[model samples]
Target chain A: MHRTNSLLTELKKNKMLFLMLIPAVLYFIIFSYLPMGGIIVAFKYFEFDKGIFGSPWVGFKNFAFFFQSGQAWLLTKNTILYNLAFIAAGMAVQVGVAILFSELKGRHIKKMMQSSLLLPYFISWVVVGSFVFGIFNYEFGSLNTLLKGWGMSPVDVYGNPSIWFFIIVGFYLWKLVGYGSIVYLAAIMGINPELYESADLDGANIFQKIRHITLPLLKTTIIIMILLQVGGILRGNFDMFYQLVGNNSLLFNQTDVIDTFVFRALNQQGLDLGMPAAVGLYQSAVGFIIIVSLNALIKKINPDYALF
Target chain B: MAKNKIRRIDMLIFTIIGYIVLGCISILCLIPFLLTVSGSFTDDSSLFEYGYRLIPQEFSLEAYKLIFQAPEVIAKAYGVTIVLVFTGTLLGLFFISMTSYVLHRKDFKYRNKFSFFFFFTTLFSGGLVPWYLVMIGLGMKNNYLALLLPHLFSVFHIIIMRTFFTSIPESIGESAKLDGAGDFTIFARLYLPMSIPALSTIGLFIALTYWNDWYPAMLFITNPDMMPLQYHLYKVFNSMQAAQIVAQKTGIPVAQMPAETFKMAMTVIVTGPVILVYPFIQKYFVKGMTVGAVKG
Candidate 1:
């Protein structure tokens, strides 16, 4: 009775704080948790009239069709591979640029370069697609013009399936590297200046100080970021891939990731809604499991770095 | 002696590794933009004659002229994007700050429960398909509300704002409470003024989202009048005939057309505002991230 009274008293004391949180609570309920009720559409036939719960149940049929499409394997491979490549390449570029930007002392030069570099990130992928089309179109492409001037042959970058992987990767790096580097630079700046000053006073030069200090310090931030990204590895970046390669079917072999495949199979064909939902369910489940497990591992290694 | 020797060795190796990596990454960041920008200025006739380059042998303002002629379409897009950015940023900042203020209050009855409610969305979502269905069900299709409503309230920004708010001293609320200030009054007068840096970061993020959003426009906005600037540029570059029509309208010489350059020029033009203001934005991004990382 006494414990219950104390608990009630505590709740009463903090009532205002909780009251303030009501709108945010309502927001999530409406937008997020409620939509989870629609996940049932994955298991059902998804009739328009019947609605999510009302739709007829078809046990694992959606899963079966999703796997049978043959696009399942292709798209899964494309999505995972591209993401792995992006994560690996993006990490390398960002860390490298960040360390360099940190080492340079010229504030003006650093600011100019950082701003110039970050400009591409501000533009939408739709605009990026236009830029790609402008430079790569067959007859009027700048590549062809330059090639002719140099008495060299102009290759059709758009038609060539092999060339797309490089172009898309380049585009991804161009749009993201500066922003990612900025994040890392901020992390580096947060490192105590005293650590560097002490090392310099002890007659340590720049390379020795960085090798001893910088990389070790950035490890936790890097690990957390990596784990966060790896959770969504199964999900493709629809905007970048779709905008750049959407209309061009020939390039789909190399470029078609899971998101695009689902979009086409579901939206374009008006085919089985169940399969795409099942695919989405699979992606989410796998992603959730991976993230949880990864967090567990991180917790085991260093509880401080674990997201949860 | 051992520590000093080790430190020197570490510095040498680190500098070597750091410099080479940064140089290569900087080039990677720089070269493509240069190619695109310089390539844009190169004559289209010359472009077909030669490949893209770091510098243009012959320059023409054809692309600029063509784009400038059909200024109405582009102008409308710009207006839509700007209005969305302004409205979304203001609304988002208000709601986020208020919500965070409530969550941060120690006397809130169900603060943890509410936090969980918002935080869970980030952890688990119904994926894109269901969200699309919900939008369609809500009659948001072809509606401007579709663009604004779906993304107006961000859980991430709320979390950041709450984190910043939690760092504020409790005495503030106590003093305000003593003065008989209502929850809204305290939030508006005391908390909002103190959280400028955090607000700026969140506000800028909201602004950028509205500005850079072609996704919402693509899915919901089929009307040409509703198309945003980035999407307008998307249509222009995809079809050369669109460019030619603009050229015809503008009365620019056909042979002097810089179609490729115009697309590049458009990219430069649209992103110019962001480039100019980025330094100011960066300061807030750095501060907000630090606060978020530490509190979170």
Candidate 2:
């Protein structure tokens, strides 16, 4: 009774301030939490008029179908492998570019490199898709044109699934190297000048200093980033996969991911909703485990960097 | 002295290699779009015969002419995009800033509690289906509200807004309170005007998001009339039906459909404005990066 009385008094005192939060509070409740309630549709057969709650429960039947489908293993494999590759390759490129910039130390060149490199990041994935098509399209494509000039037969990039692994990874690096490198640059900037000065006094060359000083110090940021990425290994970059591959069944073998698989399965035979919800539930459950464990690990390493 | 000489020699070698690598990569980054632009200007027959060329053998405005032939569709998409971006950014800015202001209020006892509530959403989501179903339940299928509502208030944006607000001195709020001003007044009159840089950066961010956004638009909008610019171009590039629609409208398929350059032209038309405005707003992206870079 006393707690209730104080709470009411506090609410009354801060009525206006609280009122300002009403829109945001309402927005989140309606959009996020209300939808979260609908996740139960994964276990239920949802009907349009029956809605999420009134739908009949089907136990793990949805999950059975998902696991039974050959696509489940493939998508899971693709999602995890692609994410790992992207992280490893992306981190390497970012670190390399950052170190290069840190070493080069030319104001004008740095600015030019940065602005040009960042251009791809700013452009839409749709435009990037067009760039891919422009280069790789069999009829009048730039790659084919170059192959002709080099007196070699043009490779059918579209028909081949294996080539896209490189194409996708290549574009990923090209787009993200500049943006991702900023963190390393900031980290590099934060490094103690005295350590570098001392190394310089000891006659350490650029490579020697970087290997000894920069790489050693960057290990933490790199690990933290890797750890953070490990938590998201189950998730895929839906935008990259969706735009690049786009219903091309030929490329599905190489490029199909959990998110895209879920999307396609939902719409495959005209809005079969439960199976997709099952997939989402599976993703979220696995993701939750990964995240919790990673957070625990990070806390053990350094609580300061723990996400929680 | 020997070490100094070695260091100088290393720098000299690095300088040459660095420029070559960086310059070549820079050109590679820029060249694809340049090729696309060049391809868009080339005539259809010549494009088929010779593939893409740096300079078109037979220069043509046929693609642009065909695009402008269905002027209404193109214009409608641009209008939808502009209106969506404009309204969404303002509404999002107002609510996010308001919520942020409340969160940053030192006197607000439950600010951390509220902050966690917002932050928790970032940790997990119900994923695409349930969210999609909810929008459907709300009758947002084929509705413009679907476009605005989903993109409106991200937790990331709110947190960034809070960080910006907290950076402002508390004395300002205290002084405003002493002047017999309300919390709303202090936020609207005092902090809002003071937060132009934050507002602009966030506003540009929101605008860019709405501009580049095709995902929600793809899901919610099935009606051709409701398509935004990005989705509009995406549809054109993805399927032949779109080209048929344009050709059907213009009666211009007699010239081999011009599908190749038609897609390229659509890309230009949709993304041209963003390209033009990019350099100006690009710095603003980097400015806010370090502070709020950890996006969920």
Candidate 3:
């Protein structure tokens, strides 16, 4: 009772702070938490009038149908593989660029490169899709144009499903390399120059210094980024994939990931609602578990680095 | 002598690797932009016959002329985008900063709970499908509100605002309280004035979100008149048939039209304003990202 009183007293003392937080608090309750109550829609038919709570409980029916459709394994495979490739490739390119940027001593070239690299980050995927279509269009695409100019037969890239993985990966790299490198570069910049000065005094060359000093310091940032990425490993880059592939059923075999698959499944048929809700629920749940576990592991390894 | 020899070698190797890496990064960004720029000016039949080229075989402005002739559609899109971006940025920055000011008050007992209220949303969202359903339930579908409201405020922005607020000297607030200034007055006069960097960063973020967003417009808007610039541009760019048909209907010469280059020109058009403001925005955003790197 006394403990409760002290807590109440403390709360009252900070009443203004509590007042300040009320709007955000109300926002989340209405938008975020209130909607969590509707996850029951994943299990229900979700009649608009009847709403989530009063809707008929359909049990595991939605999940069963989704699994039975045989898209589950394919989408899961595609999502995981694509994300893994993105993370792996993106990290390598970004880190390499960051390392080079930090090492390079020229002022004008560095400034120019920084500005130029960041330009792609500003472009929308809509424009990016147009760029892709322009380059890959069967009749008039740049790749084909170049090939024909060389007296070689132009490849029909759009019709070829096999080419999509490389094309998609290439497009993703083009859009994100500069943006991702900025973060790594920020991390590199934050590293104490005194450390480098000490290395210089110790007669260590630049390459040796980077190997011994810079890479080691970058490990924490890299690890944190990778772990954070692991949480969303199931969440594909929906915008990129959607824009790049569109509804081209041919490339669905190679390109369709869980998010896109769920979108199509919802929109294609009479709004099943339940199927996408179930998949979305599944994604959130897995994501939550992965993130929580990753946080826990981080806490165990290094408490300071743990996200929460 | 050994150290001097090693220094020269190190600089040589560093310069070589640096130039190569920088060159590749620049090329990666530059090539697509070049393709878009060149393709926009290239003749349509030529494009249809040969494909997009870095160099135009028969350069023409027919595509530009068609767009300029019927500029009403693009102009409306631009107007809508500008309004949405301005309104959304101001309102979002206000709410986020206000909310963060309260949360950062260490004396507030409910700060932790309220922080959790906001923070928990980030961990487990109802996901896109249900949220879409909820929006539909609320009858925001096809409404401009659908585009503006859902993303009016983000949890990420709130946290950054809170961090900035927490860095403020608490004595100012205590002194303000002593002066009988209301909490709102203190916030507006004292806190808001001091946190321009935080405000600018959050404001730019909100503005960018509004400017770049086609997701909400795509989901809800089907009316051609109501479509935002990015989404309108998206629809035209995606369907070659759509662009060709529009070109034909507008009485553009099929032979002279630079359909590909026109697309590039539109891209350059849409992205032009943001690029002009980018260097300033980028500096703040880079700073914000590092400070907000508190979260993964």
In terms of DockQ, which candidate is strongest? 2
- Candidates 1 and 3, the one with greater TM-score: 3
lDDT of 1 at B218: 65
Residue-by-residue lDDT tens digits, candidate 2, B1-296 = 89999999887887778777777778878888788888899898788778887777789998998888789889989999999999999999999999999998888978888988887776677888888887887899899999999889988788888878888999998998898999999999999999998888889888988998898888889898899999988999887767777878888774577888888888888778988988888888788676565432
List residue ranges in candidate 2 displaced over 4 A. A269-271, B294-296
Candidate 2: residue pairs that collide:
none
**DockQ for the candidates, in order:** 0.41, 0.68, 0.62
- Best candidate (score: TM-score): 2
Q: Could you tell me the TM-score of chain A in candidate 3?
A: 0.90
Instruction: Supply the DockQ value of model 2.
Output: 0.68
For candidate 3, write residues A1-308 as lDDT tens digits: 99899878876765665566666677777678877877778898766667666778999888887789887788888999998888888898889888888889888888788878877777677778877887788878778888999999989888999999999988887788877888898899989999999888889998898899999999988987888788789888888988888989999999999888877766664566777888888888888998899999888867887767
Q: Order the candidates by TM-score, highest first — what do you get?
A: 2, 3, 1
Q: What lDDT does each candidate get? A: 0.75, 0.86, 0.80
**Number of the predicted model whose lDDT against the real structure is largest:** 2
Error of 3 at A199 (Å): 3.1
lDDT of 1 at A273: 69
Candidate 3's error at A147, in angstroms?
Answer: 2.1
DockQ of predicted model 1: 0.41
Can you write out model 1's per-residue Cα lDDT over B1-296, one digit (the tens) per residue? Answer: 87778766765676566556655656666665677777667776676555567787778675566667778757887898888888888877887788888877767655677777777677677766676677778788778787777667887788788878888999988888899987778888998999887788778778887877777676677787787777666666665655665666677765666656777777766766776787677767555545555535
- Cα error, residue B108 of model 3, in Å, equals 0.9
User: How close is every model to the real structure, measured as TM-score?
Assistant: 0.87, 0.96, 0.93
